[model samples]
Target: MSPGDEHDYRGKDQGGRPDDPYSTLGGTRQTRTRLPDGDAGLPHARRPVRNSRSLVTITGVVVLLIAAIAFANRGGGSDEDAAAPGAEKPGTTGSAPTAATGTKPVQGKNGTIASGFAHDEQGAQSAAANYAVALGSAEMFMKESRHQILDTVYSPAAANKLRAPQDLAYSAEFLARLGLDSDGNAPQGSTFISRTVPVGTKVLAFDDDTAKVAVWYTGLIGMSGQDSTKPVSTTWKTWTAQLSWLGGDWKVTEASEADGPAPVPGDVAASRSDAISKAVEEYGGFTYAR
Candidate 1:
C-alpha cells in the first residue's frame, strides 16, 4: 500500500460501528490497557459485590439522597428555564445539538463551519485525533500561533497552567537544541517534521455530554539535515482528552500525555536524511488505525 493509504485513522470500518477501522499495523487488537480506574487487562466486568444487606442499605440511602436533591433542585417554570430567542431547551445546554435523534444523519460543526461529524464515538475519536495533531504540531513552536493554539485546544484552567511552561519548552534555547532557528523555523534546506501518526483510538468512556478518547500513536520528531541534532526519532505516546462536542466541533476540556505503550518497530530499515526527506515529500500522511 502507498504510505498515504497505510492506515485508516478515521476510526470506522467499511460499514462502520461494529467493525473498527482496519489497522495497517496488522493483527487483532489485544494490547493491554491501563484505564483511569486502574484496571488493566481485565474484560469490562463489574467486581462482585461482597455484602448484600449493607450494599442494599447504602444504595437505598444514596438513591434517596439523589432523589431528594433532584426534588429540591426542581423548580417551577422560571424565566431561565423558558427558552429564550434562539437558546436551546432547559437542562440541555452544551449538548451536541445534532445528536442522532432519528434515521437522519447527524451534522457536525467546527466553530461556525459545517463539519458533519455525527455526535458519536466515531466522531469523538476523529476530533481527538485531529486535536492531538494540532496541539503537537510544529505550529506550537511559534509564539503568537502557539498562544492561539493553546487557548483554543485547552480549557481555561489548563491553558493558564500550560502557557508559561509551553512557552519555556519551545523557547529559543530549546529550539536551538532541536536544530531550529530562534523562531522555531528549521534551516531552509531541511524539512522540520513534527507529526503524530495515530496508531489507534479507543473511547475509554463515552456519554451524550462528554467523551474521553485514548489516542495511542507514534510520532516523528527532529529536524532533517546532516548536522541536525534531533534527527527524526520515533516515539509512542497515549494522549487522553476529555472532549465536549460544543459549538459543533469537539473541544478539549483537558489533555495530558503518557509514555509509550509502544509497539515493536517494523523490520523496514531506517533511511538516511536525504531518503527521509524525499519519502516525506513523496508520501503524504494518513489516518492510522490499530
Candidate 2:
C-alpha cells in the first residue's frame, strides 16, 4: 500500500504513531506469542474485528457522499452552476433583480419597437415588462388608442384573440363602471388613470425563439375623484406572457395575469388620488435597460 493509504489496525504501541518501534534495532528480543483469535491466518475466516472495520469504512463513504450532496444543493446565487443530487433547491437562475441586472431593457428606434433584449432570456423578460406596461396603460382604456397599442405589442394571433376581448373590456359599460363617460373619458375634475408598475420579471424558461416570463407588478385602478365610485387603488398581480422575437423586437404571442404575488405591506400608507394624479403627470416613462 502507498504511504498515504489508510488501514485500520488494532492495538497500540508506546508511541501514538502506528508500526513497531523497536524493529529498526539490530538485536532481536523474545516476546510473548499470543494465540491467533478465530483462525486469524485462514484466508476465508470471518471475524468480528473485520466486520467492524467494514462497517467503519462503509460509514465513512456514506458520510462523504452526504457532504458532497449538501454542497451540490447549496445555492451559489448564480445562473450557471449545476446542482448536487437530492437537493430541493430552486432553479440555477431566478427572477430577483440581482440575477436580472444584466437584463435591463435596451433602446430601439422610436415609433418602432424599442426593446433592448437580445434573443435570449434577458430579452424575454424585457419584452414581458414592456408589454405589461403597455397592456395596463391608460391607452388600453381609450377606444381609439387601445387598438393601436394592442396591435403593436401582440403577435398577429394574440392580437386577434385580444382584440375582441379588449374591445368588450373597454366598452361603454366598462367605462361607465369606472365613473367615466361612454367615450371612456372621465368627467371634469376627475383624472383617469390606469397603469401597471412592474417590480420585476422572471424568466421561467426559454429557447432561441420562444420564452415565458412572469412579471410581478402593481397597478393603479379606478378614477381619481372623491365622488367617483371607482376610487384609485392598487392591485398586485403576476403577468405571464409567451413571447417571440419579431422584427428585431420581442412581441407578445399570448399573455395572461393572476391576482396577488403580493409582497408584504410596508409601513407606508396608501397614497390618495390627488397624489397619484400629480405623480403621473410629473413622471414620464423611460426606455428600460438591463
- Please write out the lDDT profile of model 1 over residues 215-261, one tens digit for every residue: 88788888878877778888899999998877565667887799989
Candidate 1 Cα outliers beyond 4 Å, as residue runs: 1-116, 155-161, 287-290
Each candidate structure's TM-score, on Cα atoms with residue i matched to residue i, is 0.57, 0.63
Q: Which candidate's lDDT is highest?
A: 2
The 10-residue segment of model 2 with minimum total lDDT is: 20-29
lDDT of 2 by residue, 57-127 (tens): 55567546655665655543443344335432332353345443433356564343455466677767777
Model 1: colliding residue pairs: 9-287, 9-288, 108-116
lDDT of 2: 0.69
